[model samples]
Target: MSEKPINDLSPVVIALALLIIGAEAVFQLANAGLVGGPRGVGWRMEGIGMFGYSPAVLERVLVQHDFSPDILWRFVTYPFINVEIVQAAFCAALTLALGKFTSEYFGGLKVLAIYFMTAIVGAVIYGLLVEGNAPLLGGFTPVYGLIGAYTYVLWLRLGQAGENQLRAFQLIGFLLALQLLFGLIFGGGQSWIAELSGFAAGLALAIPLAPGGWALLLHRLRERS
Candidate 1:
């Protein structure tokens, strides 16, 4: 594969990703210290104290600290909540993969905007649909955003000739199947719901961004010709 642009690995996005991961690590360390340790962290997960990443708590803190609620709702702080190493790793990897492709086609800023925006959408949908007080933790939201980005890419690629079209359709089918299988095995909840939302967002964003997407306008012009 050809090399992606520098902005795909842009310092701003990379630094932002690292800073979020670092903040989560620090928060976990502090939580462990005040509580006990890893075992204490487990207890915290079990609801021993002001433990776990709570959107409610985060929202409250943002307001108290004078941050705009709109900013908070935009998932600016959501990335900071994934303290687990595996979760953070998954998020970073997915971000790089999806960001590279998205930045390649749509530009870095647009990719970033889509990722964050869809992440917030996923989390908000989860918060509204799931039962009361079920904390929406983990980087799955943004990770799903990356999945969304890939889906959008596939959709656009489908509009191309030959193998690209076949590959695009194949990928979409695979993604849908994966979602269904996972939902069947684990039962529908936040992860599944978020994944669906991410897919939807990706498709929606891709519609306007794809080259062939505007072909309809050209087609109308040709008709008038």
Candidate 2:
């Protein structure tokens, strides 16, 4: 097989990486007083208030019937912002690494769909299940969605190769293990709900988003029936 060129990065992958890193860069600069002003220190916090999905705000919107366009936009915008550079770097790394393969396999549109849809679903789950005013921020949730898409592709490839498909889950297993360890050391937060939900959403979406995935799902269902 011919070697793929390094410069042949998918546009969707590049776009995702840029969106995440660029947002973080702006936040970092503002925080450092390189841009904006003393008021810049609060810029990211302000963005979180405006763009991050707050379960409290969601509650007010859904439970109390208080409607606002800001709440609606949060579903799509939350994934672009992060708390700090470390958080953003981790997300950007995952997005570029997994998103390249996912976009190549599922196409740019489906990859974009999975990312945004997973974010929206994740936020919805957080709104319904999680309690507190801690707003959901960061790109990790959507990155986990990409991980889910990658896992699905690996699972399919493994099954076709007559290998144990269970091995495909090792990535998530390792990540979860690390998360548990981190939580134990640093004290856990509720954001895992959104991240896990994003993963589940991505996995379920892969059933329809993957090429021939819908037909394969129907075939399996018919066989079972």
Candidate 3:
């Protein structure tokens, strides 16, 4: 991605990045005993427990066919819980970087729309596909949604330029490869399903969310027909 000034980021994207960073900042402060007192150190874990998306909780709700506002809320809130500062920083950077690019194409409001929508879709897919106690926490899934938007833009631009549209997938492919490598070495769970699901949802969303996206898609469909 090109170097766009942070100021160029949309207000909504900025707020989203701030929320992710601010959450971690509070946790770090608590860890250092600068805020929330001695018991504050547990704030991170507590927040994760309350906000993290747990398949177990989801399974319970599914079996009982019960719906709770708190359980549903985790779909949106899980992204805010970060286990480590470095992980949060990486998520924030990608959010800002990709959010700026996607906002240029879809506007600030739609950028946020894509973010939350993908987060929800990702969580639902995670719950359906992965069975375990480990919860899904962190904004990377939603951030991957932004990358999907970015890929859509590139795909459109490449087609307009008479280039191979397949090239637009390189970014996602590389990122997934890197993620798989890390997972192999560290031995992780099935969170990649969430990330990939988010990406797919983001792409699907662009059909309606992107400016003129519906009409353009229709035009392409007609061309194929």
Candidate 4:
């Protein structure tokens, strides 16, 4: 029997799953009075938030409420706890698109591994650079990583001996311009830092993971056989 092909669930999907489920569980425990908030919000609460980039607040929460590192992990994880409906919806749409494409192009396991690795890099970068007391949350970091991978695939597809090369370069130019526009409008912050990390990670991973567009090369080889 032929081996079952990998599913198109991206690394972001897995991270989001963990974030959503963890949030639900925490909220449920809070509702049942089994667990209290890190900031002593008590049960029956709705505006609970995780410490995003505020390591100091996180440390205080852990010390004051006796919370563990697991709680910290939940707050920092992707698909961050955002009460804003619009923000959540926007992230969800981009997550689905980037995650699906990346997973389909690169194997699911590889995508997951790369995503986590990049997340670590992103978090570290943000922590070192960003100085603030507010919470940070969002999956834009990993989403940026997916964009990096997509760009690599595009470059490989276009950087060839055909019309595709011209098309790919055009697409790349457009994407770069878009990134610049968003950066200008949004201004520099933790989000931008995460995006930068994602881009760096994507480019790093692409060097080995993609390398002249293995996907296309494989297809050609199969056709020959």
User: Best candidate, lDDT-wise?
Assistant: 3
CA lDDT of each prediction against the hidden true structure: 0.60, 0.86, 0.88, 0.59
Flag regions of model 3 displaced more than 4 Å: 1-5, 220-225
Question: Model 2 clash pairs?
Answer: none
Per-residue alpha-carbon lDDT of model 2 for 92-210, expressed as tens digits?
88888888889888988899999999998898898889877788888888888888988988888776676777998999999999999999999988889999999999988998888
Error of 4 at 54 (Å): 3.3
TM-score (all chains, Cα) for each model: 0.66, 0.92, 0.93, 0.60
lDDT by residue (137-204, candidate 3, tens digit) is 99999999988888888887787676888999999999999998999999877889999999999988
Order of candidate numbers by TM-score, starting with the best: 3, 2, 1, 4
**Residue 106, model 2, lDDT:** 91
- lDDT by residue for model 4 (36-132), tens: 7553334213333333444454455546774677454643464455434455566666666666777776767666666666765676566556777
Q: Lowest summed-lDDT stretch of 10 residues in model 1?
A: 44-53
Better by lDDT, candidate 4 or 3: 3
Q: Please write out the lDDT profile of model 1 over residues 1-225, one tens digit for every residue.
A: 887775447654576567557755665665667645656555424431233333454455445673555435434455545646676677766667667776677777767777767777776666556655556655566656666666656644555332343465565567678868877997854565765676677667665665555674355346546
